[model samples]
Target: MENSSPLVLMLLGAALMLCLHPLQAQIDGTGLFHDYYAKSCPKAEEIIKSIVEKAVKKEARMAASLLRMHFHDCFVKGCDASILLDDTSNFTGEKTANPNRNSVRGFDVVDNIKAALEKACPGVVSCADIVTVAARDSVVLSGGPSWIVPLGRRDSRGASLQGANQNIPAPNSTHQTLETKFKLKGLDVVDLVVLSGGHTIGLSRCTSFKQRLYNLTGNGKPDPTVDQGYLKQLTTLCPQTGTDDNQTTPLDLVSPTKFDTHYFKNLESGKGLLITDEILYSTKGSKTAALVKFYASHSQAFFQQFAKSMIKMGNITPLIKPSGEIRKNCRKMN
Candidate 1:
């Protein structure tokens, strides 16, 4: 056993490296390229943009829904458009998952975009790629920073009901739980804080935050961490008990429709709507809290980091050519 110690240590280190390699690959953005569809579908992006713009113009919240759809799709089984699949006799879709259910909307918008793309290029653009581009466009359309979206991702044949429930962080998740979920997806503290900026534009339902306002610890008292004034407002918007579970309140009360740094500012002022959103700032002396403070003061830094993080999130194990097919319809496998 004298010399076996060194050999054992080396083997353990090698195994650790092997485990980390796949996570590194998830954020590498290697096979994706900026001009992937330049020749294959010269009008692919333009077609998606026109359709998304039209839909968002008609209803501004559609922009946030599309952005969230891409996030939901990427977190589960990679950015393969698996969230778009509907439930069939043989398959159970992610739409009814715990985190999604009534929360994730904008499938109709995705369907409309898919229809126009099939006509313009005919199987040249993948549904996965279309949603990814639409998400970026949504950010820009909502007055957020812009970045060159990488293309060439294909669709997943199967949607992951379990993956959708587990991978995506919940509004009530603890600080550590939120960190772990992001880490599982190859994200860091910065990514958690920045990508959470997506909440800057979206709405959360009453059921999602009732625990905080009504019975935080089963003591029939609201969460003390939440600002009292803001808590009062939320109480009015979300009753302690009602069938208004579907009622929505903006995640960011300030500049709710605009994708900006106000989300961080809200957390700083204790106006964040979701427990998960406010936890980034309220966790006390953590890196997540520090990043929240930084973003609150420096909007430019938040935008730059946000663009980089979005690209990283988009690179999550995409199904490139020959692995996943380009679905003729985004809602059903073909």
Candidate 2:
């Protein structure tokens, strides 16, 4: 009741929430599993980033793989631990885009972790766990989702390319559309706003967002009030020329590779990198805007909500108990 002590009520509510969602019961490893997963994620991310760092260094095409994996999985059936597979079973490409995002070479760093874990723990850890840990670490490493959840979410043995395509929102989707999609995943409108914080890293091809500068007019373009100089920069980077330029911008312009409040500020300042990013502040997503306000005002609040959302998102139809096997290789059926 509103009349009850807020602190006592808060404890009661959290206890109820944990009871209703028994995933917390899975964290009985004295935090060792949590620590192991957290510690290993950086190592995996260093490898993934080292690969991307080369692209930054050589001005080469950045591998869209690691980020691609997260988007593909989360969008499909609410991050259902399926994208960690390289085989074709349990899912179909027509339903998800897992295959398309499966750029083997880019995930070599994660592969390194699997191999190391294989030696250190030998089949104790799953590729699903790898992707889950990698997703969080990837966020921290490249600048997004700051907390780490448990790593015992076992790897599944099926990869569904169609699943990715069906679930992942097209870069140009409207804020209203994205909210519905996230809602279907058991996440609220605010979850989509926060989950998309993944955009803080990675690059989107011109084809994905070019509709703004070259086509859309007036408010159809993101932040219609956004500076013309900035618009011109994206056009130049993307090039309307015969060839496509992969001109990518950091979603969080301030600390492109660090997870922070810059994303919320960007939305308020009209500097969100993608059309979808900016739309959350628009009419269709005023609630999302409210969340941005909360996140900006209370850092701890945002982190806590973000962590819970990650857990909810990760638990979608998980390969619970003995439901699936951990694949030996993430690229193909073993």
Candidate 3:
């Protein structure tokens, strides 16, 4: 009986391992986890959150900028921090990409977070992970839904200026173009609608959407879909010919600082600041239109899906162990 007891215990242990394998595989498939830095740098998330909170407190708009960094980085090279690389004599980076030039602020805030992390656990956390975590913290600070951001992403040694320009959807992109771009990244239309909710707290420059105010379709008239009152307001903010091209407007006029469904609501009212934004609801026969209406009314559903879509966006083609290095300085490869 004693000899048989050992075998019985061994069989039970094997069964347990088999049962847990799928769950473990699911978590490890992307080579990322909720507590990736728990052992190596226990205070990784704490340090990041604190720095982000400080920056956001100092400038509320910084929250949206930080979140935008993660999206821009992920879309170009799968959340590898390629967007952080500065231009060098021998190599050009993505900073000057059309989608990024004069836009995408918050580099200083990221530098602050990275500097603190290095002091706490030198060479432990990756810049890519810092951007990702800061994005989540940004959302939380902005009164948006929070989720466990899977960490362990590594920084790419190089940046792709071309990819940055091509992959990141332009503000004037058509609904089909936007849908195709997201789909190419393994995201669907729902992800498209939910992820666009990030605009809930950001601002857009006049140059991005001025065409709609002047000549949306080669005609010297504003986009007809634009609410006439909103169009008048936009023209005043962004004149037909002036230096206001660099001037800015909140993406969501209603509660621009808050991360909520106000962006979707704005779309319904034809007040969406960008053509890409309005097209989500205004595009004829677009599935995104229905989603816009649904999210506008159901704030909780929008919040939940926004969180999920963010996670999905963060999971894009990450570089794991033996793939990339942990960049010491986010702007330059280590």
Candidate 4:
């Protein structure tokens, strides 16, 4: 295989090119531009994930909430500036208490970055901006996204749990359904496939896969081609029974530990473990083969586009100042 590092760097460089696009990124009122997401600082996103993983492990419901936020933000408007709080409740509802989990307090990671920035630039940035920045940063850490994004956009007061519930896509949605839903948010097939890479870092509860593992009546269950040994292990661990949501599975196939092109590789190998993942390749007209080849022949190619898509996602039309209010808490408002 071609050396991976140079290719990835080239992809990253291209992603950073977006900052220099005609949009004119504003950094401290100066016309000068910087490739914000070009390199480094994606650790903030990883920190949030680390926290979220803990949250999920500690409490699924709460972890689900954070997961919902990440997905909602990423899918709706291309991970735009609006996902984090910036406005007051547009609708009202009962507030549910969040169970104890570290990631639920995503602020932990955001705050760290804020503190670092404050020392470096002192109030030149906003938490709202930090959260978005951290997201792109996290993508890079996960071996994706390299585009620079705008900063200084203030936070909002709106972060509704119910809205999140309504916006996030389900695990079992078909390609037609998923494509339609993603389109409503201005996303495309490529964005959907790439962002789904988030699965690389998270876990899937047995509840999400039980139907695929056991209840299928026809070809609904595991494919006949799956390794018999692997098939037996799944049965032994998840055994079609009561409340098996406790079992977890990794989303990445090769080098699951490192967030790389392995996920695409997995799809090529028919090792996509999730029903949603399996669809990526099995679905007709998908770029699965192309993405896999591109990443292998040019691993950086994936990250570059992934990064550009991420910045595009983050730029989603946010309800901004004078148009929205800052939510005291992220869970609910209305």
Alpha-carbon lDDT, every model: 0.90, 0.59, 0.92, 0.52
Model 3 lDDT tens row, 18-46: 77754574466687877678789999999
Off by over 4 Å in 1: 1-29
Residue 207 displacement (Å), model 3: 0.3
Query: Which is the better candidate, 3 or 4, if ranked by TM-score?
Result: 3
Candidate 1 vs. true structure, TM-score: 0.91
Q: Which ten residues in a row have the lowest lDDT in candidate 2?
A: 28-37
Model 4 residue runs over 4 Å out of place are 1-69, 74-107, 111-124, 143-145, 217-220, 223-229, 285-297, 325-334
Better of 1 and 4 by TM-score: 1
- Candidate 2 C-alpha error for residue 15, in Å: 16
Q: Write candidate 1's Cα lDDT for 145-221 as tens digits.
A: 99988777889999989999999988899999989999998999899999999999978889999899988888988
- Per-prediction TM-score, please? 0.91, 0.72, 0.93, 0.65
lDDT of 4 by residue, 2-78 (tens): 66798898887788776455345442232222333223343433344464445445543333233334445544333
Please state every model's RMSD to the true fold in angstroms. Answer: 9.3, 7.5, 3.2, 9.7
Please tell me which predicted candidate would have the highest lDDT against the true structure.
3
* Global fold similarity of model 2 (TM-score): 0.72
Q: In model 2, where do residues sit more than 4 Å from their true spots? A: 1-68, 77-81, 87-106, 142-148, 217-225
RMSD of 2: 7.5
User: For model 2, how does the per-residue alpha-carbon lDDT over 1-334 read when each residue is reduced to its tens digit?
Assistant: 8689989999999999756443454554211234434443445434434544544344322223454465566555434446554435444532224235323224555566677666655555666666665565555444344665554455555545555665667767777778877877777876787777655455556666677776665454444744477677777787666764455556566666555677777767766677888777654448887877677667666667776777667666555446566566655445
The TM-score of predicted model 3 comes to 0.93
